[model samples]
Target: MSQTSTAFRGVERLVAGQQTADGAGVRLTRVLTQNLQRRLDPFLMLDAFRNENPDDYIGGFPDHPHRGFETITYMLAGRMRHHDSAGNQGLLGPGGMQWMVAGSGLIHSELPEQESGLMEGFQLWLNLPAADKMMAPNYRDVPSAAIPEYTSASGVHVRVIAGESHGTVGAVQRPVTEPLYLDIHLLAGSRFEQAIPAGHNAFAYVYRGRAEIAGTAVDDRQMAILANDGAAGVVIEAPVDSRLILVAGHPLDEPIAQYGPFVMNTAEQIEQTLRDYRDGKFEAAVVQAL
Candidate 1:
């Protein structure tokens, strides 16, 4: 187990979310900043999506390009297969994850593997610093069976996706951002506590049931940004069986220029990315896994 910091941030504010459609009409709730306020900084955006109606999700996300950031997809139900510009392809099932570094640029598509009985997942965007923005693109895909899990005496199951939890390190091959991403499930009336990086900005998204974070009742699909006040970690109370995703990352603290699928340091850089995509750089890059 990672040592808990002496002081940790508590729930500061609740961020309301809205639904938005992107990538060939994949409808999802958009969380985090909608404008360029950059309130979330290194953690750009989080999308919480769940649909049982086949028509609601069967379309999936089609080919899309990304740059100057990383995209992480965690599946809780159903299956998705991805194909990228570099000829890399893989399938993600329940409890699986895919972390893609669209460093310079990359093109990819996530499509449902079947007609779809139920589909639920999240796609998180974590920004890269200006220094690492234009690096080479890479992909890391981890299956459900491969992720590290820990069960507590209270029946809280924690999936360490990209951080240390319960004495187990996450499976995510995260390097640049070195962020912590954890999926936590708490049984009814269970409690959860985990250490977080002292220097990183952190937030938690309650997806199911209710989480009493810092004594505030956070409902489903709600997010709480942890206060920056020095504190070791967060303590959560699950009145009912609840699920949440915790994310924390180092802030790039750089000027952000975002245009559709591109996030760069400046408008000129965004234009450059467009030019590169128009010039077919992502597709032409040599195929390899990171």
Candidate 2:
């Protein structure tokens, strides 16, 4: 039997992501923008991209600099090649994930490895705490086979990417943020429930098909921000074959200052980051590959 929660969190509100383009004109939806950073603490941004036309994603993301945050790229289709100034390189294909920490700073590029095909994925920016903002950069490439997955008793297929689900541990875990990232697939009339710490902020993003989250209808491409109403967990039901990502994380409750790709706790830090990049400091920083 699937685990159950006596009290389930409800949807606080629905967000229709803004359509935007970035990284050499690649089109995507900015789901978690700057305005929601504080509301969804520790999670800076979430960009969803899906395209079939080569023209839409041909240019790809050229060299860019980032600092004071970590980026997680989860690919559902196609292939992307990652290269960084610290001599780190990896290829992320369907069902693979790439996690990179731009602790101090780094220059990197993500380019398409295929000429024509469907390119779909999500890039989530997770903020680093002030104390660890200047730590050494780190990178990890988790292939599809590396991610832990299981099927619940109710036929809900789950992929544990960054936290525990049911009894299965995810591929990665962070002590500070304690993020829970689950890719859930539910067949028609299926129900799934997962316990969440009452203190953590949570939300769900429906990527395919539709589902009802805590009695609120969540359609495809919509994000439902779960209320922090002292609920013990969340409950989801699907009327059709639907897939979604459930994400919850402990809030840092710290000030956030961001300038383009750089995020810091203060404006002075942001200024220092600019000078560091201009002095070519990022190129000299060593990257520890995990």
Candidate 3:
């Protein structure tokens, strides 16, 4: 039998992300900033971008370097082309996703494939354990149809992106973090529940419409941090049609040192990463990984 959640988690706090521009002046909202890294262990940052104007995202992301972490990009609309130093290339379309692990290091670019129209998506940074920080780099492109999804009897639709949901496994899984990423759509007056492991840290980000968690209203574009108050799981209800992404992961509880795309366990490691990039070592690392 599927374990059910009797005690539901409540909203500890709500976050209204800061407006920020990145990647050649592409505007976006930085949802999970650096301050929350320790609190939301194993997760570094979350950036949400939804732009209709060409000027807002025309430049897209130019050549960039990253190391010691993973980036998960989910596209809701529009197209983006990805090219990396490791000779990995892919086109991410609507409802598609790109999961890139910048283990040792990698230089990559994500530029828009279209001139106009809505371009909505999210980029989540998941931390890597110290043991796997220097492992081989990896990348995977997952199309919309490839993701596992299901609809509950209560009219709640769920797309499992990175972990198991109600026995439906996601497209990708990491043993160390055991991250859970779910995109859920709820009809008016519908309710949904999922049993979350007690030890994992969890939160819900509402992207469309409004929803309720433990009687607290979570409006659109808001993120609700779930309290670890001995709740078995999370219970979400929609008074009206709504969409949200639920993310949970095991806490690494390790030291986090980050310096613009480089995340390491120690400041010395970060300094070494900077020096490596200056010496054009990222390309070599990518070639070695390949």
Clashing residue pairs found in predicted model 3: none
- Write candidate 1's Cα lDDT for 1-290 as tens digits: 35444454678889878888766666788887646236666888788888887777878888888888888999999999999987889999998999888888888999998785878999998888889888788888899999998898888999988878868888874655578888999998898888876666888999899898878888999999887666768888899889999887766688989998798989999888888999988777553566
Off by over 4 Å in 2: 1-3
State the lDDT of candidate 3 residue by residue for 184-274, as single tens digits.
9999999988888887888899999999998999999999999978777898999999999999999999999999999999999999999
TM-scores for all candidates: the values are: 0.94, 0.98, 0.97
Candidate 1, residue 232: Cα displacement in angstroms equals: 2.3
Candidate 1 deviates by what RMSD?
A: 1.8
Model 2 lDDT on a 0 to 1 scale: 0.93
Off by over 4 Å in 3: 1-3, 287-290
Best candidate according to lDDT: 2
Clashing residue pairs, candidate 2?
none
Higher-TM-score candidate of 1 and 3 = 3
Candidate 2, residues 92-120, lDDT tens digits: the string is 99999998999999899999999999999
